[model samples]
Target chain A: MAIPKDKMLEMLHSLLLSRRFEEALTELCQVEGKIPGMMILCTGQEAVGAGVCAALRPGDVIITNHRSHAHLLAKGADPKVLMAEIYGKRTGCNKGKSGTLHLALPEIGAPCTSTVVGAGPPMAVGRAFAQQYRGEPAVTVCFVGDGATGEGSFHEALNLASLWNLPVIFVCENNCYAGAQRLEEHTRIENIADRAAAYCMPGVVVDGNDAPAIYTTALDARARAAAGQGPTLIECKTYRWRGHGESDPQHYQPKEEIAAWRARCPVARMREAVLALGLISTDDLSAMETKVDALVREAIRFAEESPYPEPREALEDVYA
Target chain B: MPQLTVGQALNQALREEMTRDDTVFIAGEGVGVSIHDNPMLPTAGLLRDFGPRRVRDTPVSEAAIAGLAVGAAEAGLKPVVEIMFNPFFTLASDMIVNHAAKLRYLSGGKSAFPLVVRIKSGAGFSAGCQHSHNLEAWTAHCPGLKVVMPATAADAKGLLKSAIRDPNPVVFFEDMMLYFAPGPVPEDEYLLPIGQADVKRPGRDVTVVTWSRMLGVAFKAAEQLAAEGIDLEIVDLRTLAPLDKETVLASVRKTGRLVVLHEATRTGGFAGEVAAVVMEEAFESLKAPLRRVTGPDIPVPASPPLERFYIPDAEQVITAVKDIM
Candidate 1:
């Protein structure tokens, strides 16, 4: 399938916006208690979120793990509300109840995100099952990464989804790291996608930095899912450019390896991909960057201006 | 009124709710097949009636199945998930504690997880250490969750019906020993309101606060205490999370003495929570120090004789009443 010029440019804008948003959050967290809670940054893995979500329809939902800022942005979440939520402000998406770890923006079909590893897969399958029961063509995309793949829930979700042939797409962001331990140290399996094969599902590995490849693969997977062909596990072989959390010392990861992965930056790669296709110009890319930067700045300003929730409000929202 | 066992009452509730709401469904291990042989045998014939879609037979995956229930409920399905053994709740605690319980609050009240987790708990029939445990305190400690433990068959039927219709995550506890215990349950449609306590046997000497399996022990102890002219008021707390302090405090004020009994261990048990509430609210009414009759702070043993010693009995409750007196 040929990529449209406008959609390609839009994907680039969203990727850049998400990256800039997380970058600002990371910098602010370092300013001596400027930010609250631990922020997990998807520094170099923007292409995976942008590309996979690009293929989703407006009615489709995506279940995301702890590292979810990129997924939310790509799925068309309001940056102001999301930022307000990250800031724990009253007008936030969750009304200041949840910080970055648990975010829910149902308007964009990203109803909720979880902090637990391997949390999204089974829920995504269940969502897809509901859609199937209702006879809707809505697709459910589950974003799995790192320690999530090592969890028993991950395997259970995969096996159940395959058995039921639910309309769920499992996108494994194999970022070469899981907490303080490296991926090689955790699992004997060379690839997370290999487990999908055991469940009788199609498993594909793509260069996560390459936006075009991810978009094409995800688009195909989405189509297969809507057609009731069960799930497809697409492992995006990528790298997390930063530590797991904002304050992680990252002494376990070798500096040379980090520098090597950082060299294959997804944003620069996406810009090249668009340029080679003659879809967008250097000036157009620069303008998109300026627009995204301004939008992120506005979000931060909105977050700052929003008020913190009153202490008494904590007693509410538990039952309803 | 039909005299039904606790298990029969629960099964009746499931059938009634599923009939009323097409979206209500059951999913868990052995729900479809072999649940008849299981300890809490309510889901024995559910699969045959509702078929596989409604009564799903999940794999041995507690954590993921609970997650699946959360998603299903969010997507407009009333999912009743049965975690067969309470001891295995440790496997699914992350889902129940983190996702199911917190989804409503985290979603800013936009999403309601109207899911039911039927957890079987207790130590009897030599179920051994792993299969015998009561972790109601864990659920009660969590916000955004309604915890219910029914002691009578009527309450079981009524509360299960309400839990299914509730627009929040409800941890419905089924005491393993109460499955065969029979009580009068009405045939008419009934739904017991959550967060309400019932005074099983009213008296003026002392208040016995208990629920689930311990309710029986408390009743027997009340009978024994009445013979000695120490009339005991038994208050069954049907719901733990929304603790009904009003009913309990009212009873304590009338009696001027309180005794807490439960299958949970003495340390950090729900008895401590109840006792704390009493001390904080009804301290002036107390004629003596609060007494607690609870299981020992040890895992339920495998041997029948050891298990008998581990479970709190009527004698222990009597002893607690005597101590308070």
Candidate 2:
């Protein structure tokens, strides 16, 4: 499906916002000791999250793995609360109880995210099953890394989803590497999509840098799911612009390979596409950037001023 | 009141809960099917009665089974998942420890995981190390989970009913040996609070605290002591977490000697926790330092004689009680 002019511009803006947010977080972690330990940056894989979330309805749910900032942003989680969470403040999403790895927002249907690899697939299936049981049209979109496909839960979830014809979309962000290990070393399959054939599902691989292509593919998968046609395995061919997490020496990939991926950056590619089509004016694009920058600044300021959680509150939510 | 076995009581509780709450369901291996020759026995007619939607026979993935239960419970379904064997709990520990035990806490009290995980435990009939291990202490160590080990048919019926209705994750440990053990069980529906302890035999000479199959061994030991005119008080710790420390302390205070017993190993058995509670709360009342009559600190052996030597029987309990007294 052809994307509308306004939506295409919005997608470009969202992708840019995600990239800039990660860049800012990286800088904050380095200079200010804001995020104490390692912070996984979704630098080059912005389009995967933006496109997948764009297809989701208000009631639809999305489950994400450890590298989850992009998913949260795409699902409309307030950057301010997210920043506060990273700051370990009381006003954060988990009241500073969970760091970036575990974030949740039940009201918006992004109930929870896990750090464990391949954990989201089965959970997403469960959420989809719940929705189906309630006769709700809400679908569950599970965002996983290329490395997560190697876990047993991933295959089990796929088989179950196919057998039950669950309304779950498994989106594999194949960023070429799982930590320091390359995807080629992990699996012999030519494409992550090829494995989906074993489960009797449609598998499609799309250029992850193209926002419109990713968005269109996700929309098709969502549509198929809503029609009770079962799940779609979507392999997003993306790359990580930065090291796996902060403080990594990044000895696996050469500088040339990193520079090559940076050249095809999703945010820049989307911007060029929109500008070439004359879909958005230069001034409009500049204004959007300023707005996003100001929003991010406000979030950082809120996080800086937010109070840390009380020590006594630690045991309060242990059980419900 | 009707005479019912522990397994029958469990079936009765599950049936009662399912009938009362439309959201309650059962999912596990051999749940909907009659795999054991006890064909269609415990969950006998549940599949036909509730249909495939409610009585689901899951794939042979304990992790998936448990993860699915957690998800279902979080989504407002009361799920009773069967692990078939106690040793299989190792496979599901990720869900039990990470998700089921931490969901409410991680969600900041926004979600409740009302999941009851039922597993058959104990080393009888030569089921060997893998099938016979008792890991209640491992579960009890977890903060958010409520662990229940009912020794009697009545307690099984009452506790299972309570577990299904509870708004927290509960690990219900059912001893395979007690499945056929019969006792008087109430016919009408009832709920037993999770943290309460039951005193099986009242005595002042020594206190014997145990639960699950070991509780029966403790009682038999109490009887042998009674024949010799040595009074023995037996306290059944029905729930592990939110333990009935008050009852245990009171019993220890009255008897002035205490012996904690269980089928699990002595190193980190539930008995150790009971001993700690006694030492912490009623240390002055002890005639001697607390004694723990537990299975040896080894895997349950395969041979009948070796398993007999490994597990703490009534004679061992009697010996421990006498030594403490």
Candidate 3:
């Protein structure tokens, strides 16, 4: 399918917004030292989230993993509430109950993002089973890192999805690292998608830095899922530019490998692609960047001003 | 009212609830085929009635079964999934403990996760430690989960009905030994409120606190003690979490002595929690030191004779009560 000029610009906007949001969060964590809890960023993984989420319908549901800010943003979650949540403020999306790792926005089709590796796929199969059982044409998208593929739950989820022929799209963001461990050290296979063939499903691979390519692949997978053609595993080979968390020195990562991935930055690549489209000039792209920068600043300001939850409220929300 | 086995009563509950609500369904390994071989099984004939869409027979994947229920419940469906055995709960603990139990709390109580994980517990049938171990304490320790253990046919039906309708995730424990035991169960639909203990045999000499299959052992001990001019007030705690501390405390206050009995081992057992509650709230009412009659601190033996010895019997319960009295 040919990408439209408007949707292409929208994808670029999402990619830029996600990149800026994480950049600002990194600055707050390292410089100001205000954000609490472990913050896992999708800094170099903008295209995978932006492209895949852009293909989902409004009623479709998504289950994201620990690196979830990009997916939530691409799914149209408000940065203000998301920022407030990471700030542990009362006005945050989960009322400060869930920190960055477990942040979820059900109203925006992303419910129950988990920090447990390889846990999202089984839950995603369940959501898709619900949609299929209820005769709804909607599909569920599950986002997992390549490290998650090693979990037993991931294999169980894939086998069940295939056996039941449920409408779910498994998006594997192969970022070449599971925590500090490099991908080559953990996964022996050349591609994560190859594992899909064991479950009798199509496994497709795409360049993680190419937004349009991912968008096209995800759109095709979603169409197959909604048509009751069962699940499709789409692996987006990408890399994260930052350390696993803010505390890590990341000495395990080779300096040369880091520079190699930085050279293929998804944000810069998407910007060039958008600029190449004659429909938008360099000034238009610059204006979009300025708008996204202002939005990120507003999110930070709202988070800083929001009040912390009362200590007594800690006992609340345990039941019901 | 009609006499029915515990398994029959549970089947009636599943049948009635599925008929009442379209969203309620069962998914588990061999649930449709009834692999346990009990003539009066809860999942018998469910596949024929609800069809495969609702009565899903899954692979031996406990994590997938549990995770599916969590996702389905979040998406506005009430899923009643089976884990076959309680010991296998370890495989599904991630979805059940970390996800289902905490998702509502993680969502800031905005989402209602209505799901039931039906697990068969107790150490009978010589199934050994791997298959028959009771882990109700594991789930009861979690904050968001409601734990239910039915001792009689009536409670088996009523509690299962209530669990299916509950807004939060409930772990419904069924004793494998109690499946064929016949008791009076009401034919009409009824709901037993969770977190309420029932007084099975009321008396004032001493309080015998128990639940699940241990209720039968408590009754036997009461009978033996009653012949000796000693009475035992038996309090069956149907729900472990959201525990009926009021009922327990009330019984203890009236009896002035207490004995906690269960099949699980002594270390970190739920019996310890009961003792703690009495120590915290009704310590002044106790006439003597309370005792706990529980299984030995060892894995359940596979031999029928050793398994029988491993399980705490009426002799042990009676001895515990006598020691406390």
Clashing pairs in 3: none
TM-score for each predicted model, relative to the true structure: 0.96, 0.97, 0.99
Model 3, A260-306: lDDT tens digits are 99999999998888777675899988999999999999999999999
Candidate 2 chain B has its poorest 10 consecutive residues by lDDT at B34-43
lDDT of 2 at B236: 94
Ranking by lDDT: 3, 1, 2
Where does model 2 sit among the CAPRI classes?
medium
Cα lDDT for residue A170, model 1? 93
- Root-mean-square deviation (CA) per prediction: 1.8, 1.6, 0.9
Q: Give the lDDT of residue A195 in candidate 3.
A: 97
**TM-score rank order:** 3, 2, 1
Off by over 4 Å in 1: B38-40
Per-candidate iRMSD: 1.1, 1.4, 0.8
Question: How do the residues A194-262 of candidate 2 rate in per-residue lDDT, one tens digit apiece?
Answer: 889999999999998778899999999999998899999999999987888887879998899999998
The TM-scores of chain A alone, one per candidate, are 0.97, 0.98, 0.98
DockQ-wise, the better of 2 and 3 is 3
Taken over the whole model, the C-alpha lDDT of each candidate is 0.89, 0.85, 0.92
Q: What DockQ does candidate 1 score?
A: 0.74
